[model samples]
Each structure stands twice: as structure tokens, then as C-alpha cells.
Target: MAISITQFASDSNLLNTPLWDKQSEILEEFWAGNYAIAVWALGRRSGKTLMSAIVATYCATMLADEYKRHLRPGEKFYIISVANTIDQAKIALQGVKDLINGSPILKPLIVRETTDTLELRNGAVFRALTASSRSGRGMACPLLIFDELAHAVDTEAGNAAGSSLYQALSPSVAQFGKIGKILLLSSPWIQSGIFWDLYKQAASGNFAHMQVVQAPTWEVNTTISAEFLEQEKARDPELFKVEYGAQFTGNIAAFIDNQLVDAAINSDRGLLPPLNKFNGTYYLALDPAKGGRDAYTACIVHYDGELVVVDQFHQFAPTWGDGKKTQVAVSLVEDWILEQHKAYGFASVVLDQYNSSSTIQRLSGRVKIRELTWTASSKTEAYSKLRELFNGGSIELYPHPKANGQIKNLTVTYRPNGTWGVSGGTGAAVDDYPSALAGAVLMATNRINKQQIIPAKSYRTW
Candidate 1:
């Protein structure tokens, strides 16, 4: 484990190479460190690929030797590697090939040939893969390397490329105590991608013995000027930060303005009224799904200015033929309303009226149903009002664990025209959470202004 710089270069045949500068020094330290996970965010043309190839060769040789000494007949040693795309995988393999071809001591390892993989002489294998096309359910590797970690997109299944790739290596490493190593190298692109998630986790002590080295484009290569970077930022501010500055920024095209949303969230104060005041008036707001797995059936409970998110129900409904599912959904809503009506005596249940009119008709007798329509103007107005209410500290939330999780996952981004929208990746909104919260605020504030309130009439003597 105490790998010296001279040993690494002599064994790998990279002593006289162009990458044997200060950058290689950092990589050498990383390789010899005791960290379980090491992240190297190298800049453009800073010889990152070459350094990675050298590291891969070193690991392959070391793991192969270890396997030989402790050989079980059926034991498999794997060097699992990943890239962003097929072409990138090929490029990574080319680096591995370069190291193999350069080193006189390690040149005989080439045993197989393909577009994206190389089989070694000592029964060990180097498998190149793209993050998007990864199916790592059965893969078990003692050594795992993820190249260009920042380019992977966020998926609905929670494990973005980095997480998924790591999950695949977990089983293999679990058996080999203190022998497994994971390497992650990338030029930072988006702030909220797989790289950022892993970095955050590693930073927050979720992962043991993790080392992070951030090599900015300028620091790694002096040719990358500040003026040139500024021009790139002017063209596309979001892309520039990720590409050159090596910063992790959430979705640049984010729907909601993060600053506005952050301003609205009152972390200091708990729910507006204490949790004991459960007898107040309450109403449910629903945002029905459009179709497919993309959308979710969201529901929220409104009690005064405090928005208590009760549940978020999501199901993929392909066939809307007779709308039987819609009716069933409405029936369930009716039952919930009746139960709540017996307790809080809600004035009226409000719902987005875009796609659920028939469902509304089905529940006419059981409760007072109000169909809420949102126009482009109205939507803008409502969002503006919600922003104001949030900034003004008028909104309160019940400290429910599920609600807190959703809120933590909530992210906002500004549009090109300076408008805002809300979104989440691991915690994206599927149902009426955002809309219902907006609706509750609007109903409390706007109902009085619009004169849409239905007052309890007095039965006077005729």
C-alpha cells in the first residue's frame, strides 16, 4: 500500500512522460493515500486521462498480484471502469492501452480487443462502460474507476451514474476488507449532478476516508486565462461555471428562482401555530397527474396560513378510456373530505380544474367543491404572491419528516427572462405539493379580495 512515486513511474513506464509534473505529484499523493474514495477534478489538457490510465495500470497490476497469492479457483478479479458515453469509453481504454504499450514491464497484459474493453494477461479484466447504459447489477469489482463523473445526468431511480456505479462495486468490496479502492475523476460541469452528490456525501462524513482534489482549469494549465473564462461566462453563465471554473451548479435552466425560494423558507420558526391546534378549519387541494410515470397525484392540506402537506400519491395510468380510475380517485377524495369535514368543517375543497371536472361532478353532493383554474396571468400573479408571502414570513409548515425531505429536495432556478420555477431531481415534485401550497396561500389571501367567499348565511325570521 505504501506506493512510492519512483516505484509507480518505473513500474508503469511514465517517468519521462509529459504528465510527470506537479499534477502527477498530486495524483501520486492520491494513489498512496489511505482514502477509500479519491476524487480528482482535473482541468482540460492537464493530462487527467493520462494520469487516470497510469493509475488504472498500477491498480490492475497490484490487484492481479494480490489475486494470484490468494487464489480461489472460482474467484474473479475485476477492474470496473466507466465513462460518459461510448466514444469516451474508447478514449479511456486508449489511455489504458497507452500505459500498457509504454511500460516494458507491463506490456504483455493485452489479451482481448474490442471498442471499449481490454482483457489482461493475468486473468484480470478492464471493462469500459458508459454511465447512461450501465447495467451493473451482477458486476463485482475490487477496483472501480469513474471517468468524467460530472457529465452524468440525474435519473428518477435516485442513483445517478456515480451512485449506481458505486452500488455495483459495494458487494465486491464488502468481502475484501481494506483492499477495495474507488477513483472518481471529472471536470466539474453541473453543480447538482452525480459528482456533486458524491462530493457532498463524502464531505459530510457519510463515506469513510474520502479525499477530494479540485484542480481548476487555470491552476492546472496557465493558458486558460481569466478573460477567456469571463467571455465564456457571458455567453452561458451556467455552463461556464461547470466547464471552466469547476463549480457544481444545479440546473441552470431551473424553473424556480432559488434565491426567492430560499428567502421564503423560514428555518428558525417552527410551524406557525403549535402542533396542538388540530381543530382549525382545513381544506384539501389536489393537482391531478397528466399521464405516464412523469407526473404524480399530489395532495395538500390547508389550515389557515400554514400549509400541511398530507400525502403525495403517484401512479402511472395509461388508459383513461372511461376514466374509471379517475372516478375511484374522486371517491377516495370524497371519503377523505367527509372525514376531515366531520373534524375541521372545511369551507370548500379546492382543486386544479384542468383535467378533473368529471371527478369533481362525482363528488358534488358529499362536499363543497371549488374548481380552481390557473391562467398564464393568474399563474404569474399567484407565484408572485407566494414569493411575497414566503419572503414576508407569513407561511408556516408543520415539522413532518416527509415534508422536510420534500422541502430539502426542493430547488429553484431562474429563467433567461428572470422568471422562476421549482424543481427536484431525487426530490422532484410529482403531485400537488407546489401547486397546492400555492393554492392554499392564494385562497387565504385572494378569496377576500376576489369576493368569492361563501359566508354561513343566517336563517332570519321571515
Candidate 2:
């Protein structure tokens, strides 16, 4: 029989330090062949990538023959480390590379290496790739590590879909029977997706062949201090709960119905242009970026009597400076808005008065500025109006995947201060698009209300 994972690491000198107690237990349990599936809902900075790398290295080296026996004569055995994106997958791949480089025994086994793949002399192949159902098909995989599985959204579908990828890949491990293992590791997210489904099954004590481990960062990584966790919680309690406490936030909930958002999208239309006759009014709405986390967003919308059309959507990305300071050029954003105004001649420019004083001052003489003082009541009203438009099927959006995804991914939290904290999901998810869309829809609704109230203006186009 092949040596245990811990023994393989020791013989090869693969790890710089010994595995933590929980990490050792995880490997030990997996090696005991009690489970075909292992789910790790760990907190951030819990050394998930390093642990996954160790598993991959051991499978590629020690368990090579056992896995290959079921394969065809020349068919390669695959060990895949896939994540939400290629860059994230590469972190785990790099860890494996570092281990092999540090080990005299394992280093010689690498017959070939590339940026995203490793091939051993014994015909074992290791690959790092982005999540896709098409990519995972027909491979003879004995070990598959799905890193950050909670965040694995279907980029191709332009919606939150992970089940298809899971269904496609999970079956590839069937040939090896008990020897085949699929490991999923991620920080806890919303109570959805395949990861959550498996976690629930494991927790229910119904799936005897599935093992699940859940632990906070502080519990798993002893070096993380209480003071640091305290600071993180003070900064953003909901996010800290998910990122460090390993808790699925019960407070944060999906804001918009995804089916409603999907119904509002016009897939065939891509950024409609302004009308040539200029008979109707155009509204320009802006959501300025506060910092690096968000993109500066603007939307140009046209509301006829029956339909609301988003003519254009603009997003300005930030440039990173030293120490990772992000600088989004306000002047560039101003210029783009002015260009849109030159084309559409917007009747009213709507924007929140938060972090936009300078922009307002610059456009004071150029356009009609309708400033929204974003109090708790104002935000609730705006988002509610946007949701109303979506549910009514009166608004149409173009095929912008990121913007559409943002709208679908938005979540609402009722805070202790009696305010609705509306946001996109944590960690790289932003609400800039949704914010601008809300502003535009709010303005459109007000225009319709105003037209109805004034008898004389009822006939006029707006």
C-alpha cells in the first residue's frame, strides 16, 4: 500500500512546516477511505491552497499506480485544481510547484511543467484551470480539488449557476470507486450553490460517504490573533462573519429575484443608441466610486410611456499605484459624461451627493444636476423603485454580463440602525452597476409620476 499523505510529505520534505492539527485530521480521515467526497468550509487564510497542493502532490506521486490501473493502456491520469478563475487556480498550482522544487525525490518525477499544467514521468497529469462544465468532461480524474467553490459562478451563463459544472465533473471520479475523491474548499457564502447542498447533506448525517469540516480562521490558523479578528469585525461585521468566522451570513439575503432580472434582459440587443430625432428626454445617472473596491458607473436611460430603455452603460476601472492605491480619474469620468450629454442632451443628470461634490461642481453649469441626498429612506426608495420596474417587466437591459451579474448578485441586509444595507456579495463583488441602475429607474419613475400629476404635461414626451 502507498504511504499516508503525512508520510509522503515527510519522505519528500514537501512541507516547510508540519501540518496543523485540523489539517492533519482532514487528511487522515480522507486517507482512511471513509468518504468519497470531502467538503471543507473553512475561513480565509486557513492554508487551503497549501493543503490542497499537498493532496495533489501525494496523489500524483504515491497513488499514481493505483489510480492508473483503471485507466486505458496509455490514457493519462489527471489531478485537477480548478477554481472560479484561472488566476485563483494558479495559486494552488504554484504551491504544488514550490513543493516539487523543494523536494529532491518529487522534483525528478516532473518530466514536464508549464504555467497551468504539470506532467509526471509515470503519466500522471496535473492541471490548473477556470471552472467550466465543457472543460471537465471525459477526463479520468482520481483527485479533483475545487478551490473556492462557493464563489464559482458560471461566467459563460452570465448568472449564478454552479450545479452544471459540478454535475459534469463529479462523475469523472466514478471509475476509481472508493479510491477516487473530490475535495471542495471555500469560505462560506450565501445559502445556495452545490457547495451548500453538499454541506447540508454532510451535516444531515445522511451521507455516510461524505465528510465535511467547518472551522473559523482563528480556530484553524493559531497565528491569527483575537485583536486582528476584532478589528475585522469592527470594520465589516457581515463580511467578517463570512470571511473569518466561517459563518454563512443569515442577515444578508438576495435582494432581487434572479428570474425577474433575467426577464428584464434583452440578450439580442447590445447597448442601444440614442434616438436620431431627439423627440424624447434622456436621463443620465451616475454612481461615483468611493475607492478601489468599486467601479465608477453611469447609465443613460430613456423612458417612453410604456417602456424604459437603457441606452448606454459606462464603467471606469481604477489604476493601481504603489501600495495598491486605486486612482479612478474623475476628470476622465467627467469627460465621458459630457460626451454622453453631447450625444443625448440629457434633461436631468441624477447622482447621489456622496463623494461627488467635485463632480457636481464641475457639471453645475454644463447640465441640470438633480442631487440625491442618500439617507436611509432615499436608498430604500430608489432600490424599491428599481425592483418594481424589474418585476413589472417595463425596463430593458442590454447584454452586459458583469453589470447584469451584479444586479442578480445584489443582497439586502437590515442593519441594527433601521437602515437597509444593500450591497453586492462580499470579496470582489461590487454594486456600482446596480447603484446606477437604481438611480436611473428612480428618476424615470419620478418623471412618470410628474407627468401624471400635471394635466398639461401629460401629452408631452419625457
**Candidate with maximal lDDT:** 2
User: Compared with the true structure, what per-residue lDDT tens digits does model 2 show for residues 1-462?
Assistant: 646777666563555547877788778887785688999999998999988999998888888888878999989989988887778878889999989878877788888989989898999889987875467678899988888887777645521456677787889899999899999988887676677888899888888898889999988888878899886765445567788888865546777778878888888888777786643388888888775656778888888667888877888877554646576887887887788888888777777776777777778778776676666676787786676667567789988998999999998874321245788867643788888988877776777677321111111122
TM-score of 1: 0.50
Residue 194, candidate 2: C-alpha displacement in angstroms: 0.6
lDDT of each: 0.58, 0.78
Q: After superposition, which runs of candidate 1 have C-alpha atoms over 4 Å from their true positions?
A: 1-7, 10-22, 69-71, 74-76, 133-140, 154-162, 191-193, 205-208, 223-234, 252-462
Judging by TM-score against the true structure, name the best candidate: 2
lDDT of 1 by residue, 104-223 (tens): 766766788677777787877777877766554455566678887766543554325456655655565544456677788887655555577777777676666787777667777766
| Per-model TM-score versus the true fold | 0.50, 0.59
